[model samples]
Target: MESTREPAAPIAELDEDAAQLAALGYDYDTTFKRDMTFWGNVALGFTYLSPVVAVYTMFSVSLGQAGPPMFWSLAIAGLGQFFVALVFGEIVSNYPVAGGVYPWSRRLWGRKWAWMNGWVYIVAMFATIASVSYGAGPFLGTLFDAEAGVNTTVVCALVMLALALFFNLSGTRILNTAAMVGLICELGGAVVVGAWLLITARQHDVSVLFDAFGAGDGKSYFIAFSAAALIGIFQYYGFEACGDVAEEIKNPGRQIPKAMRWTIYIGGFAAMFIAFALILAVPNYEAVVADFNAGSTNDPLTMVLISAFGPIGYKFVVAIVLISFLSCLISLQAAVSRLTYSMSRDGILPFSKKLVRVNERTGVPSTALILAAVVPASIILLSLLLPDALVTIISFSSVGIYIAFQMVVLAALRARILGWKPAGSFRLRGWAFPVNILALAWGIIGITAIAWPRTPEAPWYVNYIVLLTALGVLGVGALYMWLKKPYLVGSAPSGDATSQINTIAARPREQVSR
Candidate 1:
């Protein structure tokens, strides 16, 4: 007698007919031409830095005690990210799709465990959208020096979300152009600011850059800096947004990997400069810290600029900060919509095809874009009632992205280690194995460090949120397996839809526990 369990879908090279079918709900018409030049790619790098978010996180937390170690923490996180970026560079070259990590991991590990990768990524994206959009309001409000318009920020985020949705739904051309513009307006300014800091630091008391001052937490200098690294690291993580737009990029297998590697190195270095400049310019360290902690409107960079280069410099930094925030808002919206489109196309989400439908003329994911706007809007509304919830949500969301990164990195490493190389349009050579292993170790350490309580000065809830979010992802993945498995069986709508979904749709189940 044969056992009753259904056989899994066989992994095979997709032929023409199957490929066409998979492309149906994939918003192919909206696909942008692969016209991205190296400069456009560089602009994409700056967009990920999103200086506004970086400045906001550092000033708010660093004010408490961390000071310049904040910049050092960023460097440490960048080292870990280097490995993760390498892993991404390799996998994305082979499997470049909007779904990104989840699909790559599942394929590497076998479908039995793949769902775990996709589900965690989906939840993580949702949380990230919530957190970043929420944080946007305060940063903008700080620049304006006004009470944050709960409605205004929410509305603004929603509008930004809508614009991103439309652009993505419209086509790759628009998204690429917008991303390029964002890189210029925001990232260019950040590089300048970072440069200014480095140039001016030598003149001021340069020791502040080396000062291991504590914010009264009593943690070792290394630990404090590591915690600070979390804040800085947040700025760099979204560079993988390039991977999510793979379908729109021409020869994505080559370009996506190239984009990821370049973005990390360039963006990471750029952030380091901006951070150092901000820290060093503020020779009155206590006052800078005080202003940062006192309220949301503390513009430390502005203050530092005034001290170093006078009022003219302050105005320039302020202009750059505003532009940077605007660019970030745009990029965040783009990331959210594409992620949604990728998930919906996979039938892992409801109305998969319809939700991800692209407007042929505009080359955007119309429905998914609309829905993405709703999430940020809702988050903005939540901020009205709960002002403090913004950063907490963003911090929580960062953990989810890290987990997704880890899973993707592990899957890529496993494949390379197990002699399972799939030829793609682009490739990473030689050190893939060693670099990936190092990346995995760094990711584990960073995740564990972020999960632990960094300061007793803060409430216990910070650590609890991290734990709960982790458990929540685990429980949600299990729940999908138990309740939604039937809907996802081979050759069914979900199964077929899975082919059209982004590469990161289904994660391998085993990896979650690991």
Candidate 2:
């Protein structure tokens, strides 16, 4: 199967893709050129789920909180998220709509249900971009030999955000190219550094994983482990980004589903392997844990990389990490913008018409792309107000994303209970219902694990930021839905779609197909 399913795809194949869209009640969007190949779709998801960026930014948090044993939380998280990914595979296989979560939920449950899903997902994505940008700031500071401060980090974050926006706005091809590059850097860097360190600089024994670094040695450690699992929770998402640009993929029906699964398979492996190798290679494990416990800003990852790769090689690795972050930013921006464009196309947003407009020359959603960048940039400014703003934003983002994902899984389950069947080629033979149930269960568990308050010593707001942010987004969306009534009785498309679904108590089939 060729990755690139060009417009010259067999008439039957092209028709199949278009027919699925038609079944979903949308015409093929000519505004988005179907330029993304299969691997390019995977690249979008992979880069968005960049292992290097995730592991580098989060490794310290996990290690600091729960020591080397925290590494296994990723394995647990991966296994759990695989179930969510499987459910999503079935959903995307059937829906294959742009904006992944938002559009799929819209058709599955209905309009107001989807409005909240898109709102929370979009806000979380912007926070994600800001988080990644801010996380990459210290690396940028290292690369430039600049003092680590608010001004320097903000400048660096803004610069990276601008560059990501510029490349995303340039065109889909360039965006996909950079995404592939990002995938390469993250996967290859993780493997090369992981293997190199494990071979040449291995310091800790396998028993270290069982040691909680004096935090606790009993079942009480479960609490710390769950708190540290945020890394895995955050790392496993962005696979849905493949289906986010469904209209941009040439053979989205088949390819997007495959891409989503591969992203989890490959991306999850890389994330875990890197975390394992980093933990094993820590030269002074006791002292490293001590500094982290002492509230020192010492980066355990930098120390390990410098010890293994030396100063020059450390810089080389930093460059690769920087590229991975920038690439992740680009993919995130692209996915978020496409989601915005998709929702706007349904006339759901404030400036729906302008936001939905695609640039003729580039086939990019220009206004939506700009909005994506602008929102994240505004988020970056908030980092200056809060100490450890990156961590706060990242925590909210991880949980918000979980909340959003679970909403989609819930919608799919509801539609299934209403007699919806898998229509796409990819489906879990007799396992769809069971798998969907497990996925929903896993998602709820993930949301609880990540959103649980770990900062009891901090202010109440900071302690509960993750839950607060999620509730805030949902609250605002619900209020807007009540006040504006965007899905009112006579409104176009969504309101009509909601009516059709509401009537189908026995069979949740689309009106178009009916």
Candidate 3:
């Protein structure tokens, strides 16, 4: 008996998408399976941002630095990031290419700029994976009732990385399903936990949200507030996961932009709500701050959860956090692999041919996935070797990502000034100039804030590590470009529109699937 199944959908739509891409001078073949729908794309962004995971990871640091006032940073960062997202949406709608910033920069500016953008972005993404995995270590330790030491955290982080790689290599179907599951778990966990904490609140005064009780170490409240803003700055990123996987998304020009904006709006609200709930729930804010200042290994969030829900319930929340962490890792790895594959496909990176190869059976970028995993794992191992360097290394995650992002935003602004109008479904029209300028300004401030030396009292090396690391990464990337000149010069669209159209229309349809 022969089994009956509908024939796979014809490649007509895929071919059309390829044509649209070619019109923008991006003539690459569609190697990715367009299995991601609108919601799936949004899920990818949400899981990558992973508010619960981010808040859980940074709560102690932010609370210790700025007390309850740190929660307000979310609103500030969210507004700033919305401007950035607006620019990103316009660009991605016009150039819905894989490797979000890299390819977009290539079309808007030039190859050299795009190559450097990708270089910074790829490094930042690797750091993010390591940081997020290490962040999850405490929760994992809590769940297992294991000691939260350096060695244990390193091991846990490595395990998380390995699991994320497995899911990434499993192909888009499984990965998307896992992302959707993560989105549900993330939303449910935030709402349920937040509502519970709010209902049983210790009722700290509203003024507490503006008080910088922990501002000291020769740092004024303004500096402390800037430091606290790092929490929101870091949390608001990763929404570009939607744009990074644009090739895999259906109706990307229309859907990807919406997904990106929605990711920011929704993720921001969730992050703020959870932060507010946790801040209000703190039975004794000063005590938690003192514990953090005393270098306590226990997470401040753990104390709040224990107070609100007891040991068993706290464990349950830990489990949810673990899920959030795992999903975030998975999303990060997926986005990084696509970015790697995109750069490799354009011959911008070394070992381009090998890195661009996709597994025909699974439609996955196997080599890129492995590369993404190995680099971050090495970073993690490096941190283990020099445990004190962990903070400096992790600092690269947020700063690096923002730098790459702002680079693209700058490129888009330059293009707009030069009359490079968006040719997609989304456009800002009259509002483009002001929004782009604001986004650029905000990004500059953000990069400075994140890289600024928070602890002036500490050793000079420790204080300047973030700035030094960012400079070192860019310097190396610039050196690489100068030495190899791997940029694809003269790749921009030059021929007449009619001729280009004729060329694309004449190309064999089978080429779309190549």
Residue range with the least summed lDDT across 10 consecutive positions in model 2: 1-10
Q: Compared with the true structure, what per-residue lDDT tens digits does model 1 show for residues 90-182?
A: 666655566566556655665535567666666666666666655555445545565655665665555444554555454556656767777
Model 3 regions lying over 4 Å from their true place: 1-14, 28-30, 386-390, 489-514
- Alpha carbon lDDT of each predicted model: 0.60, 0.81, 0.81
TM-score of each: 0.80, 0.92, 0.92
lDDT of 3: 0.81
Q: What is the lDDT for 312 in model 3?
A: 94
lDDT digits (tens) for residues 1-514 of candidate 3? 1111122334444466666565555554545688887888888999999999878877888888778888988898889989998899888887777889888888778778888999999999999998888888767877898886888888888888899999888889888898999999998999999999988855786778876665544557778778777788888987888999887876687788899899997798889888989988887777777776687765678778998999999899989989888999999998998899888877778997788787765677888899988998898888866645445555688899999999999988887777675656778889999999999999999999999887766889778888999999999999999998988543544212222232332233334345
Task: Count residue pairs with overlapping backbones in model 3.
Answer: 0
TM-score of model 1 (CA atoms): 0.80
What ranges in model 1 sit over 4 Å off? 1-42, 142-145, 148-170, 195-203, 217-219, 287-299, 305-316, 384-387, 455-462, 486-514
Query: How well is each residue in 140-259 modelled by candidate 2, as lDDT tens digits?
Result: 999988998888999999999999989998898998899888888889998998999999989878999998776533437777788788888878888999989887886576787789
**Residue 413 displacement in candidate 1 (angstroms):** 2.7
